[model samples]
Target: FFFSAFHCRGIRDDIEEEDEQVSDAINVSGAAPPKLCTSFAHFGFDEQLMHQIRKSEYTQPTPIQCQGVPIALSGRDMIGIAKTGSGKTAAFIWPMLVHIMDQKELEPGEGPIAVIVCPTRELCQQIHAECKRFGKAYSLRSVAVYGGGSMWEQAKALQEGAEIVVCTPGRLIDHVKKKATSLQRVTYLVFDEADRMFDMGFEYQVRSIASHVRPDRQTLLFSATFRKKIERLARDILVDPIRVVQGDIGEANEDVTQVVEILLSGSDKWAWLTRRLVEFTSAGSVLIFVTKKANSDELAANLTQEGYSLGLLHGDMDQSERNKVISDFKKKNLPILVATDVAARGLDIPSIRTVVNYDVARDIDTHTHRIGRTGRAGEKGVAYTLLTHKDTTFAGDLVRNLEGANQAVSKELMDLAMQNPWFRKSRFKGGKGKRLNIGGGGLGYKERPGLGAESSVSYQTLFLENCIISSIFLKSERKTCMMLSHCRIVASAAVCLQPVALKVTANQPPELWGIACLH
Candidate 1:
């Protein structure tokens, strides 16, 4: 599945080639009609707004924008499932802006007409910026509300009559609780990254905010994955909606090349990571994901010490610090971002070329989430995993699960690993130790060094002698023994034998051989 971007460079090239071919055809056939450029003058958009679109170099509407804009302009609920970085922000923002500008003639006491809630502060800011850019034609006011910034500043912005507010769930809920902003007059609501927000357990906050909006208002839900839970939430909030899925929801970025490298127990995983970083330094930006916050911090610090520009982000950091780290990474001042799962989700860095999992994820879900940081918006990217002995089992399980889900790891990556010198020398071998077969007749018998001819001994006496010898060995090894009345002995030895298995007659008197023999 693919999501095509209208103004993408690749798409522009294709259009250019088509235009050349069309001109050639027209020259050959004098009967061909000349192409005409239609203006948006008759669409009722403000003259200045149309001018701004032209100034922004937008010639025609993208497929998503063309389809979504009209519906949103009509104040209809929409569910848009498109590939990440498909200009989805503009698809929803343009119409919303047009509608708000159309309603700007309302009295001075009017409330906000639109509210866009994103899962992360970065995305919220991105949407906020887009809205400001598209709404430049009118005196439209917009403010971004997120936890990392000052609440007082946001309140002030709201009080000043910001017509549109793009915000994160937590910060938006705070504003609602403080009564600093009223959504009762809101006519448009957008839930961007609805699936991610639910996964982050922001359901209650989202519901509370949704409760404040007018019941009859238009609601738009957008996400990469519109699974059952997102559908359920949409059912609870949206009216009869126009559902748009541009591509397969489960389809990952095809341009991304993924590889898993299994390592020996004593190998330095950090060294392998540093080498990959060096290799990727010439390839735009890189985002490295680690499982723990402490690991992220330590790894970032170590990378910095090694003369690589890197930033760190985790849950333990305050909002201000997190914002700074993200800002630095986005500005390319920091080429690498070592982050935990919390900091990685919902981030909108478009130029990231590589995503490295410093450690194999404990589960398949986490593995998928981590690699998703790269190869966004149809850009070619790469994902790498560093696996230690302890991670082998989990990595194998994750790969198998992904295959079962029809997201197979690329065989090209496996071939690449086979050619790598490091992989050749340190690759993981098969399971250790040979399987022992106990099916032979002499399986339970330990052969003595020499056979001794002794006086006649009863069968029960011989069994008791053997039991005593086994009990002594077990006592020395800190194991347990269970006796069977059928003259069979079940003795468990440490480091070799399986757990004791015994069957005793109900009438048999069990003898207590030694205290140490009982586990």
Candidate 2:
């Protein structure tokens, strides 16, 4: 019942997929999928909402919006799985505006008619801005409540009577407890970046928030990546919800040109950044993502010393300061910004032309969101990830994502990925107790005596990429695999050997040959 659709952007179609197959059709499951809405006009939205959409210059509904909007309008719960920057915010927000308008106006002291929860404060603020932009025609009063800002101010705004509230989990919970706001009136509930919320350990807070909302509320959960935990959470919250999946989860954004650079070590990143800093800055706004808050500050200080006027943003900064930095970066006053993953998820700045990963992300999901900061709203973007040997733990997944998006995988990065201990274990499926004959003096395979369970080389085959193994058996320097010191290579005139067979592993590519040599 699942149908897949590609993000209708300038994605490359000519590149042939040689690894795992990636489908372009958007998948919709659960009951009958709602009819896809080709345009905003199909929704028959309020005139004011239509005007705001037109003013936003939306040419057409995105893949997620096409299917998600209709499902949401049906008043059924929904789980939207799509790549980042695929208009997921609007997929739920548009329907939410329609839902809000249909409901009676909020009485004094009543909480928001719709409550949208996000993972980060930045995302909370961004969604609140969207609520204001689109809800203006209906005279909607939306307030953003999140941590880092003054609690008194947020409480005052909430107490002033808001029909829409966009906020983070902790802050929202605080307001609910203090009686500053109530979820009793929230009929339209949204969990934006649901996976991220779960990742940040907000599962309890999210469940707590949802518990306060009416059980029959129309719930929407959207995310770029989904996990088993998220699925479990969805089951607990949503009822008979239709699932709309656009593009592959954890797949790299095809609209962004991804480049991976293998460095000698982590320390070399500064030099690499310095070399391209001016070029990237001159082109357009650049966002440099680091792993730690200290890294962001240190990098920003170094760049400042080099006379580059850049902004620094991290969790350590105060909310007001961070807001100013984001504002400056967005307004083009600061062309360069050094930040941690705090700005990675949902900071929608169209001016971000380039994203440089000063440190490799810890996981594929985080990496996906980090690069997603650049390529947004159908604009072409470029992202560069600087990797060292230490970061090759996730190199295999990175290579797969890159290949899945038809992005170029550098030979250095590919080699490291293959050599990585984790990748090797996955590739060979934990080579243990398996034995194959290694040729000695003769060209044909012969069972060597006493080469059974106790043998050092227990693996049956060895995988080689684009390497040439001659009659001379080069020592197997790979730490993951055992060396076949007992066997000797015999030169033969016949190119093809006898019964010794070769086959490709399921996770690996066809070109990756698994061969047991005459050694």
- Model 1 gets an lDDT of 0.60
> Model 2: how far is 287 from its true place, Å?
0.6
Residue pairs clashing, model 1: none
- Which is the leading candidate under lDDT? 2
What is the Cα-based lDDT of residue 189 in candidate 1? Answer: 87
lDDT tens digits by residue: candidate 1, 262-302: 66642477878777777796798888888887787778888
Task: Tell me the TM-score of each prediction against the true structure.
Answer: 0.65, 0.77
Report every candidate's CA lDDT: 0.60, 0.72
Model 2 residue 446 CA deviation (Å) reads: 48
Error of 2 at 220 (Å): 0.4
TM-score of 1: 0.65
Candidate 2's error at 318, in angstroms?
0.6
Q: Encode model 2's per-residue lDDT on 1-519: one tens digit a residue.
A: 532335211121221120012123466666544445444555656577778999999988787876787667656678888878899998888877767766667788888888999999999999999989998888888999888888999999999999899999999999889999888777789999988898799999999998887654678988887676787787778765677776655566889999888899877988899999889988899999999987887888989999999999989888889999999999999999998988888999999999998888767788889999878988999999888887766777777678667677788987888878766676587432111100001111121232222111111112232222222111122101111112111111011111111211123442343343542
